[model samples]
Target: MNRTNCGYPLLFPRQNWRHYALRSLQFAVALYLLAFFLFPVGFLFLKALQNPDGTMGWGIIALLFANPVSWESLQNSLIVATGAACLAGSLALAAAALFWKSDIRPSPFMELCGFLPLFMPAFVLASSLDIIVGGHGGLPAMLQNLLGISRANASLLSLTLIEALHYFPFILIALHLSTRASSPQAHAMARLGTSWRRLIRQVFVPLALPGLAFAMALTFLKVIDDLATPLALGITNMLAPQAYHRIAVYGAQDPLAALIAAILFITSGLAWFASLGFIRQNVNLFPVTFNDNRPPPTSASMRGRFFITFLGVVYLGCYAGLILSSLAGVWSHTPLPETYVLTHYLKAFRFEMSSLYNTLIYCGFAALIDILVALPLAHAIAKAPPHWKQRLGWLVAGTLCIPGVTLGIAYLALFRDIQLPLSNLPLDATGLLLTLAFSIRGLPFALHICSLALNSVPASYIEAARTLGCAPAKIVSRIVFPMLRFGLLLAFTLCFSLAAVDLSLAALLVPNENNAPLAYSIYLHIQSPSGMNVGSALAIISFALLALILFGIIHRLHRRQGSHRTLSPPLFPTHRTTGFAHESSHH
Candidate 1:
């Protein structure tokens, strides 16, 4: 028997080591999900059932349903969510179909327009729209004169439209990706003399259904979970706002708040479960291909381009009030500000620097955690057996069903009595808990992107490295990391941005005003008449900073790609390959 240094046996030693390492990593991921994600949420449900006497019962839920306001809130939430989903889905489908079926190309500017909403908080958009049309002023006056509608009706319409606008991009992106995935089938059908309607129905629709369903479901969930938008619009007859009211007025220890959160969780979970079947049908087997050799653009294509540009302009125009408010020195009952100054911006930096610091510390930590956890988790899921793969993937995706407010409520309930190690302060009161909440909330997104990144790397590269006696860590560091750096950076940026704008969690989890994150601080500022300009200033600053960061990251990644293309190492060295082959032959 031949023995290697520090090895018990050489026979299948690599296999043994690899198996243990994989198992250990999987176990670690499982433990993390259980501890941070499952445990807290489970505790919330349990707490909702706990009676004042410390016995388990459904009395809290019974009480919740008994209240007329609660029932109305539930109905309103359902209506808004469903309406927003349908509206957004319709717009996204139309835009996607036009781009896919027509000669019109989606410009980078169009893509940026779709992506912009993801970084903007729902409340910010709601507030901006309110400024434009909330009261009997400006756009609202003109609309009322033209349409003859009451202010109350207009408010409700604005709320629904705001939600739809904020979420349409999700469906658009999904449909766009689905089109790419189904391109080959589409081309084949076209070549076979298929009718336009038949090709669309048979090839495009079926392939896009999964993505469409998932996106609609996601939009519905987001709308349902949104607390800030309703609150900002002064629409309290919604589930999220009601839940926040319960907590805010009755405190975190309130059983009714827990009950409302539990209901929200159940509602979102059902929606997610309904969409799971569609999600499971998604298959990506080919690279995305575009019609690069198309003929000259026609009138229809020109119309399509014009329509897309119009949509982008309209969406950006929605933020005109916000931009003006940020720059305004004074304005009262006017279409625009009377004077413009940098005073608001100066005030935001002077007094709200702590909020910025807190946001960076909390969201930055969360994004880091997401990348670290998602990298291994994505790899493990990719390597998992088919049955386990589906299960693990759904499990990660299920995090979407756990709303930010639900998680925040859960953390407050679960960790109310739990203290940080060696500290007298409760665990729920610290920024650590907030960071963990952000991580859990952002994990699904990070996981999805990381999975895509991992899938892009060929399996043969990893296997070759292993066969060349490179350790798993070395394989990832040398081969996987280099290839995945861009994707990882993108995931980090996305997670950080998402976490930063998450007003629901920040509202519930913020320890105090002094330590509040920027989103929560902005919310506070918006609530005050004197602070409205400062709030707008803060929002604008946040947006500009995020945009600058994203631009820098993209530029860096592009530069790195160019450098790598010109001066990169061989993916697999010839000498190492020969040695590995020789060793295999000897064995």
Candidate 2:
């Protein structure tokens, strides 16, 4: 060996093991993400870019922009989305302000009730809205008829109302946070000999602006991207739904749908970026404090209270509409149906049993397996030194940015041509492959939830176990698993819930009827004639199944949380670092 200034260093080559390991991990993550999300999207974009002769060209894009029909549909979509966002944002803001800021008697439950719309299927909501709008005999339409309005006029109005009602919770959560985050110091300064208008303009609005923007951006994305609503509302010939139709019904004709999807890919990406930008620019730096020298509480007048009560009543009525539609025998055009039957439930269950079975198998297995794998992955990611942590976070973050449909397509592009033989097993079965896809899709989410739980773990306990000579495996099993069970349960339940209802990949991976999930099966039923009753049944059954699962998960979670709250020790101060440091000085 050659002598050097530092002779010890010259004895061997220094290994940068962390860099090598991180690079390898990043490569694996990239491969999985591209296979699952990027390639299929790129493939479609490739198709969209080609001419009939298969040469790369923008002729398809040109044709789409030049066509009035496509423009009209696109324009209609934008207009409707704008209306929905404004209405939803306004309602959410009002509700959040009224409930969260004030000494409202019923606080948390009201907030929870407002979030019910999220659980609703787009088609089911549309169907319920339709029944309410058949309002020549319906309440709103009857009132409008008394004022001498036409049925045509009512449809447009109904669309706005339905969308607003369904989407307002987005704004409520956002604004509620904004309201809460307004530092009491800021409010105090504003209130001390300041004009009310100036106080709101300077203190409240500026603080709340970020929340408003977030809510609006999210609301806009939902309204614009929704396929079921537009289709159910008979706007299928429009841009967004047309894009869907090209994939589902009209793939043989022109490839306009690909172009529209490409547009969505670009636009939604830009929107998300803009939203993130706003959030980054405006996030509060100061600590948010509860109002002290409590601003004298205000109460709504009797008339105002009654008005709020009426809004609540209407909300309950809409919820009832969802329940009744699921059970109705035949919803004749009436104010409200007087009769109902279980035929819808029975028919749907019989028709969708196979689909339900397939979906359950895939979702349940994927979720369970994903959580199992993610435990190690998340521990590594979370517990890694700061120098390495960001690589793992960024790798997962990239997957999160890609839309589900795009990721599904990536899997198609990557795996479509590959074949394998592994230990006498067939390397590719549709069900098994789909299960893998679902699991891969959920990795980012699993990583996120588990990492948060892992981060919360007190390192002292871990060190104590090590000091007692515990093995790594034993330490993880005995100490870590029990502490983080609630988070894992949440991760699995959330993952399963998402996979159970998803239809984004249905077209790409599920071709045969037997492979259809509940959502896809219902979509198929609705696409054909004579599927209304049975379709409603399927929709309702799907809803019921989802509801039951959700209830069970939440109930279990609540029990666990209650146990933690009751059986666990009271809170104590800790340092923010060294893996949740305990009080060094015993008090």
Candidate 3:
């Protein structure tokens, strides 16, 4: 008998090799998720429960809740989070609605204003506002003299407004996309004699709820988990800063810090779960078609144009103090600086080069790792069976609940004693751990884009290639990779930018000041009176660098496509039935 035809062949048959390869790939992905994500987070929870004698109990958690400061911090975090979400959502909803009704074409400058906050760190916003309104700020004396407002009260008010301003774009983008998706319905309703109010009440609200809920939930999580902003504002009573303080002062092994991190984790997870519930209820809202065939406006309404311009100007005006601080020589008590100079910029370049380099190296590696893992994970989810697809999608989405501080704490706790190969240093002592943390944090974003890209590819093309007996490697390299190049590029850019601006992770994960990322370095500089100008200069440089990188990537992409295609706003996935629903069913 031929060995190949035997019931038990020595080697696997050629036809079944692909199946084995796929199984191996799935196994590898599962292992990676467990090792990098599940274990660290799980250990953090365990650390919070463990007693000093190594016994497992709830004593630490109980002690945490028993403290009045902890209760106060928790209450403050919830209040701030809720308020910021509402404010951001309201602003975005109004802006999006106005734009939709007027059909105004946004200028490139307007577009930049709307999206600029996404590329900046929240602390930068907080600091900029402080420079304008703090006790020793340029405008505080002037404002106090004219408006009868104290700098103290203004600083308090600015904290929430700063967060709201920084995060509103997320909701704005979501609302814009949802409006486009539901435009046909709106027009249909309008043609049937439906009033504007009724149309908004019935069709617009329901269609927009999924996107709004997801975006607002995201905002809430961001505000609650934000460490640098609260710290920069000198508001250490919030949960994030409290946890950071405990870890920084008491060491990573502090039980109170672990408990506080646990609280933050639970709170974030609950918020995310709530958003998913809202998304589930509105699963049928999105239309499959993405194109908008409406004619470009030849002349926008004067009122609409004025409103757009006013908002753009006001938003950009918030950063005026930051610009001046970077260039100002002195005259802090005046409305403007006495003299302008390049000394701050020169100092930033001289002393902060290491910090800037650290950011690029760490965030760049993290982005690379994100795309590498995201491609296979996205493909696997697309090809999974219905039940498994939902499970895998949720598993990936769960990564968003892991706050940066919590993840950093988990890394320190879980990997503290694990020595690196061929080195005496522990894993937590090197930049590798920081890069890995960033990768885990950014995986969900990368996966979302990758899945969308993979969904765009025609199944028939893949099936035909398979019919020709092309190997999986050949299919991916020859066909899939070419189509996925743009999406991969976008994923990398998003991950890199997000990581670079992550002050929370950098604050907690850096082993020493020498290895600090630019965000942390800026924070340190700002804390010193003499170094404030240098910090402001560094912040501007960071902003410019990120903007240039993004512009270059987008320009290159445009040239490659041989068209002036603008970027499409990113869409958030609703529950199992909307975004990934199509992905799962595409095959």
Which candidate's TM-score is highest?
3
For model 3, residues 432-504, the per-residue Cα lDDT tens digits are 8899999999998888777777775556667677768877678879977787787788889888888887878
The candidate with the higher TM-score, 1 or 3, is: 3
C-alpha RMSD by candidate, in order: 7.7, 8.4, 5.7
TM-score for all models, in order of appearance: 0.85, 0.74, 0.86
Q: Against the unseen true structure, what C-alpha lDDT does each candidate score? A: 0.74, 0.57, 0.74
Kindly report the root-mean-square deviation of model 2 from the true structure over all alpha carbons. 8.4
lDDT of 1 by residue, 230-253 (tens): 777667888788878888888888
Stretches > 4 Å off in candidate 3: 1-22, 105-115, 134-157, 181-193, 280-300, 466-472, 556-587
| Ranked candidates, highest lDDT first | 1, 3, 2
**Candidate 3 Cα lDDT to native:** 0.74
lDDT of 2 by residue, 1-587 (tens): 22222111111123656445555665665575565455657776776676656577888778787878788766666677778888887776666555433423333334334444544445556665555555212534654576677654444455556677777754665565555534344345545866545645655565555667756775666566666555555555455566656655654223466667666666656665566544422222111122234444455323334545777787656656556665666566666666788876787666678888887888889898678767656645544555466566646543433444444444444455555555443323366566766777677667766665665555667766766877656776897778788778767976776566555555445647778777778766655546655766777676666667556654664565523421111111111112112123211
